[model samples]
Target: MRKILVVGAGQSGLQLALGLQSHGYEVTLMSNRTADEIRSGRVMSTQCMFHTALQHERDLQLNFWESQAPKIEGLGVSVAAPGSWAEGPAARAIDWVGKLDGYAQSVDQRVKMAGWMETFAQRGGQLVIHGAAVSDLDYFSRTYDLVLVSAGKGELVSMFGRDASRSPYGEPQRALAVSYVHGLGPRPEHPDYDAVRCNLVPGVGELFIMPTLTTSGRADILFWEGIPGGPLDVFNGVKDPAEHLSLTLELMERFTPWEYARATKVELTDGGGTLVGRYAPTVRNPVGRLPGGGLVLGVADVVVANDPITGQGSNSASKCAASYLASILERGEKEFDEEWMRGTFDRYWDAAQHVTKWTNAMLAPPPEHILNLIGAAGQLQPAADRFANAFNDPADFENFFYEPGKTAAYLASLS
Candidate 1:
C-alpha cells in the first residue's frame, strides 16, 4: 500500500485522509489537537457550506450532521441604504431572498472536525496527535511515500512561499469576527424557512446571519467582515464571549437594525463561541521545500487562502480534497515528485481559480456594474436565484460577474 502522511486535522485534511484510507492507502493523519481539545476549543469559522461541497462529504460518508443541522433553503440580501445607520430600518435599500436550488448548511467546525477525528480513528486510519513542524515533516518524509500539508495555520504555512503573481494582497483585507449564539429568532421576512442573511453596510462592512448546528444544539452565527480600520473593526481585543456577543448585537443595531431586532435575546452557546482574526488573501506555491531537501505538497488553505468575504473557505477546501483525491488515485505507482505535486495542484487550480477570482473580486470595492447587478437582483427572481446558486458553483460567475458587458447583458436578458 502507498504510505501517505497528511499533516493537519482540518476539513480538507481529514476528508482527504479518509478518502485515501478507503482506497487502501496507508494514511497517517496528524493534528495539533485531539478530538476532545477540538470540541472544547474556540469557534474556528462560520463555515456555511453550499450543496456541491456538501455532496462531496456525502460521497465520502462524512455527512454525519446532515440530519441534525438546519437546512438553509435560501440566501437573502439586505443592503443598508445611504445613511441608513442614522435613518433606521425603514431606509433599507435593496431587500430580497434568493432560493438556492439545493439547501446549504452550517455546522460549527468545532463540532464537525472533532466528530471527524473520532470517525477517522474508528475507521482504522492512524491518528497522530502532535504539532508538526518542518523538521517533523523532514523526518516523516523519509518514511511516508507522500507528505501533504493541509493545515492553513502555524509554522508549516510559511514553508510554502507566496506566489507573487497570484497573491494580489500583502496585508490583511478585512478584520473578521464571529460569534455563535443560541436564541436568535427567525427572520420575519422569511420566518417559515431558514436562510443565510447577508446584510451589507456599504463602505463599512457586512454582517452574515447564519443558522447553524453547533456542539450544543441548533444555534446561529453572527459573522462580521469589516474593512480594515473601519468602524466595525472593533473586535480585535475582545476576549469575553458575552462582550463579543454584545458588540455583535450593538453593531447589528447600528448597521442592520432588522437583524438586531431579531437577535436581541441571543446569548453565546459556549464560553468559547467567539473568534476574531484576519489574513490577506493569498495563493502560494503548492510544493514546500524542507530544510533537509524533502518536498511536501500544500493543500487547501495552505495553497489558496482567500478572504472569507465570499464564504468559500470550507467549500474550496472540500473541492480541493475531492480534486486531489482523484489526482492521487490516478498516479498509480508513480513517484510523488515535485513535478507530480505541481501537476496535481494545477489540476485542482483549474476549478479553484474560479473561487479565487470571485473571492478576490468580492474583497475589493464593488464596481458600478457589479453594484448594478446586485441591485437588479432585487427585482428579478431568476437573477436572484442565479446569484445565490453561484455561492455553490462559483465558476458560473465567469459567465456574467467579472465583465461589465456581461453583467449588463445578463441583467438585460433577465429584464
Candidate 2:
C-alpha cells in the first residue's frame, strides 16, 4: 500500500486522509489536538457548507450531523440605508431573501472535527497527536510516499511562500469576530424557514447570522467582518466570554439594529463559543521545501487563504480534499514527484480561482455595477435566487459579477 502522511486534521487533511484510507492507502493523520482536546477548545470557524461541498461529505459517508443540523434553505441580504446606522433602529435600503436550489448547513467545526478525528481512528487510519513542525514533516517525508501540509496555522504555513502574483493583499482585509449563541429569535420576515442573514453596514462592515449545530446542539452564529481600523473593529482584546457576547450585541445594536432586536435575549452556548482574529487573503506556492531538502505539498488554506467575507473557507477546504483525492488516485504506481504536486494543485485551482476572485472582490467596496446588481435582486425573484445559489457555486459569478456590461445585461434579461 502507498504510505501517505497528512499533517493537519482539519476539513481538508482529515477528509483526504479518510478518503485515502478507504482506497487501501496506509494513511497517517497528524493533529495538534486530540479529539477530547478539540471538543473542549475554542470554536474554529463559521463553516456554512453549501450543497456541492456537502455532497462531497455525503459521498464519503461522513455527514454524521446531517440529520441533526438545521437546513439553511436560503440566503438573505439587508443593506443598511444611508444615515440609518446609530440613528436608531437601522433601516434597510434593500432587503430580500434568495432561495438556494439545494439547502446549505452549518455544523460547528468543534463538533465536526472532533467527531471526524474519532471516526478516522475507528476506521483504522493512524492518528498522531502532536504539533508538527518543519523538522517533523522532514522526518515523515523519509517514511511516507507522500507528505501533505493541510495545517494552515502557525509555522507550518510559512513553509509555503506567498505567490505574489495571485495574492493581491499584503495586510489583513477585515477584523473578524464571532459569537455562537442560543435564544436568537427567528427572522420575522421568514419565520417558517431558516436562512443565512447577511446584513451589510456599508463602509463599516457586515454582520452574518447563521443557524448552526454546535456542541451544545442547535444554535446560531453571529459573525462580524469589520474593515480594519474602523468602528466595527473592536473585538481585539476581549477575553471574557460574557464580554465578547456583550460587545457582539453592542455592535449589532449600533449597526444592524434589526438583528440586534432578535439577539437581545441570546447568550453564549459555551465559554468557547467566541472567536476573534484576521489575516490577509493570500495564495501561496503549492510545494514547500524543508531544510532537509524534502518536499511537502500545501493544501487548502495553506495554499489559498481567502478572507471569510464570502464564507468560502470551509467550502474551499472541502473542494480541495475532493480534488486532491481524485488526483492521488489517478497517480497509480507512479512517484509523488514535484511535477505531480503542482499538477494536483493546478487541478484544484481551476475551481478555486473562482472562489478566490469572488472572495477578494467582496473584501473591497462593491463597484457601482455590483451595487446595482444587489439592488435589482430585491425586485427580481429569479435574480435573487440565482445570487443566493452562487454561494454554493461561486464560478457562476464570472457571468455577471466582474463587469458592468454583464450586470446590465443580466438584469435586463431578468426584467
Candidate 1 residue 355 Cα shift, in angstroms, is 1.1
Taking all chains together, each candidate's TM-score versus the true structure is: 0.98, 0.99
Error of 1 at 181 (Å): 0.8
Give the Å error, residue 101, model 1.
Answer: 0.7
* Per-residue lDDT of model 1, residues 18-105, tens digit only: 9999899999999999999999998999899999999999999999999999999999998888676764552578899999999999
Tens digits of lDDT, candidate 2, 222-330: 9999999998899999899999899989888888888998998999999999999999999999999989888999999999999998889999999999999999999
In TM-score terms, candidate 1 sits at 0.98
Q: Which candidate is the best by TM-score?
A: 2
